[model samples]
Target: MKIKANLQNLQKLLPSSWLEKLQYIHSILLFRWILHGRSQPLACNQKSAMVFSPHQDDETLGCGGMIAQKREQGTQVVVVFVTDGQGSGGLETSRDKIIQIRKQEALTALSILGVAPSEIHFLQKTDGRLQELSSQEQQQTIKQIAELIKYYQPEEIYVPHRKDCHRDHEATYQLVKLAIFQCGIKVELLQYPIWLFWRAPLFILLKLQDITAAYHLSITSVQEKKARAIASYSSQIQSLPRDFIKHFLGAYEIFFNAEL
Candidate 1:
């Protein structure tokens, strides 16, 4: 659990996907969580928190429960969508149509997570091309994010973690890393699961939820909102397996949020 442990060692023992996951967690606490020390709470009187997601539904699919719990604790949460997710072959015949659908879905999903419409920010980045952005563009994106960081000035910033099979997730992570440091804000970067990590069962350092503590949302509106959000991405449906969506459509929803 030593932060000083060679990255090459982890690289040898774990696949690239798993290694990327650890890199994110390590950034937050430098392996203290893995070493069995007690986890520290955020600064007292914190009111606002931010979540950065690559797609429309990821924020809700990944952390809706914890978001609700935090809101109940009197924290104001802002969920940012990095992309409209408009490049699927199946969801629709046109990109414009997909964007329109996704925007509505995002608003509905954020509402389910207890966020007001004013709290949502859409960056409108192209979905699926997040990593292909040029270095120059990436730098500019970082600078622009600094302005946003100043505006929100959230003490807790959650971004998609590395090891995501989806390119957008990785790009969003890189942007968040650069922006937070550039803005000189010492916010904790929490990772949310997307394609590759959903089936993942364990983490080397942190486990934010336990089987005993896992609770289902009782409000049927939350489930409906989740469904509406997922359905909003008409363009990306082709990328998802039919079986995956079939199994996912249910009243129950669970998620994990852990800082490295």
Candidate 2:
């Protein structure tokens, strides 16, 4: 926690752009080290899995490779987008239009990863404001997710990392976790990172347990498919920072195991 506090203080002193660049560089180095480090390769033996994304394109960004590999192995994979993506627009585009555009992009991306259209679900919750949901609204959202879990009964569930440096992502993790517990099921929970790479230092993000619990899914064989899947998010690629989306196209995707 002290490391995170010092980094937060340093962040306040540095230019925003410079700090982001530094974080990105450090993230890259950390990723490379993990790729070669002691983490074991993931075994794709699950009969079924579900991935929860806070936004339209996050599923592809964080779990695209694993999804692709699992699909190839004949594992049933369902993807759920928790938000409506209303905030992903510039001043020119209307909220509803941006939501529709992002939803279409998500469909195309997941299709490329071999997830059937029938298996993709959109919860249509408010974007960029998940943390602002009222107490009753929060329970309603959790109940909705719990219903889906009861229906799917997946052996494994994937969600954004708890400390992903984005409020929506953090909220998604908490919501999904509560839903899992509510359903009273024992399932493997895998947490993947997205914005943390560009927004946080590695030292501040890692806990001792996480270091030993890291898992790597090798996407080398399916990297091209993953690349094409990521490319389907043309809206994000054009609007986000230059090269920001490329970091996810690496040979491996990292996930950390979490329990209840």
Candidate 3:
């Protein structure tokens, strides 16, 4: 019954037919085994880390359990949300109202994940339009991110994977890369994939060499906390497909090492 309900939600949100969805699931399963066999258990040893999210709920979706565990270990985790989150609102809702709602939701979610409000940073960049930024605007965004890196001086950084199949995610990765370069900081970059499971092209999936090198972090101890944190994103829970939510609540979180 639960699976059926989630599939119904997915059908409404995605244009793909049932057959296509099944194919996607098959690919995900095959890749999951490959990743599992090759992955090493990730350690929560960093004293400080920065997580860059393309939107409000992405941090929770991608690495909420990791964040919870890191906080438990007394690691300073800074979450940076790159967009205003206004793009998720319905047409009937006012832009400002939705943004405020998303911001509050983010606060509630992060709080559940043990992130202090002071440690959260919202860049307020226009959502869904990161690819359309002017050169000057891009430079400014890069500078802002660089400044944040300088301020945090984290030993590690997390961002969406380059092939996550979302434009915003891709743009965020590029911007963060540039920011690291501009700041001349040497931090381990861990890329988390949100859309790749369902949206990545076959060619990307065929990159076994790269995909197999991914790391898996066990969240068994903090799975409850992660679920609570994910639940706090009420807006997203009610809007996005339920299966998407379920996928994040898995026993482990996967992260790819930066392709330096």
Candidate 4:
């Protein structure tokens, strides 16, 4: 009780901006401590795993470490790019050219992670407009996703958390959720956070109930490979802030068992 009171008094004495900075620092330290010394082996062994990315770089940004670890365990890792990723570049760039570059970059990134070209799938949906699709288009896309799921019969699936701020990420989550339901397949669903952390407060993240099922895959040994894979997305890195790169290169990758 005394410690709590002292902390309160200290907070009251600090300026608001300083308090905010301290809060951010505390959050980072807490997150690192939670991840530290909790590293474990890859969750799936010798089973096929698939990742659904809203764009080319998301798979690497959100779950590259896990993906690399799975592949190292002889798991067949498949990456499905849900959108063309043309929206990442400025309007001045040619959309077709951007799409081509992004696809090639994805291939390079996945190759560094031990994924083969044959395992990569592209939905070819229009970027930044996935959520605006007509009912018919939406159904078609869902059916296509279901078909791939059925064909791959992956034992584990990775997708972005539904609460992610990006519309395409949310739409990809919905589509993947529906596809799994339509396929009537029982697969382990692991959700990763990308833009969600950027928008949510540190205190709110700390209070998330989903953290109970969350686990971290140790990527310390493969951190260099993961960094190279992320760097493959040159088109994206050109626009994104440098700090964003640190999130993926952390000692471990976090995953939550999402129920949908």
Candidate 5:
């Protein structure tokens, strides 16, 4: 039977025990959702918070809701865009044009989130090539980030989670971590998952127990604003899959406390 064939294929792909555990986890999540509903809106109180985005859209995709909440609370939120995002605009578009478009889009998106133009920093590094930077280039990049951290003296820092699937995300994490260490500043580090949602669902499920302090900040009120911010990046939405944009929506944004 077709059903039996599918079951056999799934079993071949994953051990039966693993499948059972996955089912159990899914059931638990469903039960929790039914019983408790979603979490309530949580305020961000940091006097200063900095987000290091690997590309133009990562910040919005990962923490747009939190950024809006923090801005509403009068917290200074600085967004540092680490790359030009040239690789995201598809092969038809010229690299220079893509960079210009992505930057403008980022500005518009952050502005919609209530961030001032003065608070955004664009590193403009080569797109899709962060992992290939020379050692000197890497040090220079770290120094630049260190300077920003020193200047802002933020109380909270947000960056891509280390285990994120994208090379750029992983490189951004490493850069931020090293910069924080170089600056010798004590701050709360919060790691946000973006590409990990699609690429590493199993890893996330397995590591759920390792999350020390998870924050599911509700963005029901600002969901519209967040959606608008995401829409500002028209080029990305056109080039990338629709699901990529869809993943950032919903009632809440998630962050996990990370240790340096």
Candidate 6:
């Protein structure tokens, strides 16, 4: 009787045909909310965050919605780009041109997302060689981040996870961790995944922080930015797995609070 009752309740949220496909998801999210209770309402003054990206477009792919949501709430957000994306294009495209183009696209993306110019900081490292940085260089980068952490003193920081699939993303994650450890700041750390958004469901286990951002997650908006961002990479796009676009279409801000 309970099974039948539950099914009747589930039917209201989704079509009958989708019940089989969505049963686990619905039950898990339901159980999660029950255990986690509800997110406390944050006052506008307390909504500040720092976001670190391994390269251009990462901020968009990972935390764009969350950033918009915070920005609208007058939450302070600072975006730090770890690389200029020099290696993201083909031989036909000069490295200088590709970097400039990606920078411009990033700015355009920020405008669309409502992040201001003062909030962006570029680390200006070699695009594909972040992992190969000298130990001294890595320390220097981390020191810079430490200073930023001290200066901004954000209550939360968003970074790519150590388990990131890409070398640059993974390296940036490590660098941030070292910096935070060095600074001894007790700020909450949230990890956002681009390549690993759904590689594992466990990645989305963070306390959901929903603040109703302004972007219309319409197919038209997502597709337009997605195509432009993907096209910005002339040679790099084909090397991406076939399912990449489909994955980005999920258009949801996912996070994990493992460090918290």
- Return the clash pairs for model 5, or none: none
Q: What are the TM-scores, per candidate, against the unseen true structure?
A: 0.65, 0.91, 0.88, 0.83, 0.82, 0.68
lDDT of each: 0.62, 0.87, 0.84, 0.81, 0.81, 0.66
Prediction RMSDs, each to the true structure: 8.9, 2.2, 5.6, 6.1, 6.3, 10.2
Q: Candidate 2: lDDT of 29?
A: 76
lDDT of 6 at 224: 51
Give Cα distance to truth, residue 86, candidate 3, Å: 0.8
lDDT tens per residue, model 4, 160-193: 9776768999899899999999999999898887
> For residues 81-185, could you state the per-residue lDDT of candidate 5 as single tens digits?
999888885647678888888899999999999999999999989988999999999999999999999999999999997877789999999999999999999
lDDT by residue (1-260, candidate 2, tens digit) is 78778888999999977876777687787777776785678865656999999998899989999999999988899999999998884535888888989999998999999999999999999999999999999999999999999999999999998888899999999999999999999899999988766776565666666645788988888899999988888888877765468789888899988877
Error of 5 at 87 (Å): 0.8
lDDT of 1 by residue, 202-253 (tens): 3432344421122233334345655665665444455554434533454433
Best by lDDT: 2
Cα-lDDT of candidate 1: 0.62
Lowest-sum lDDT 10-residue window in model 2: 203-212
TM-score of 3: 0.88
Best by TM-score: 2
Model 3: per-residue lDDT, tens digit, 90-110?
434888888898999999998
Runs of candidate 3 with Cα error greater than 4 angstroms are: 1-24, 27-31, 89-91, 203-206, 209-212
lDDT of 6 by residue, 1-260 (tens): 55556655666777644643454454345334422453232223345899999887788767766666667667789999989888774435788987887787687777666688888988889998889999898889999989998889898888886665578988988888888999998888877666543232322442244211112222333445444544544344454443443344444444656453
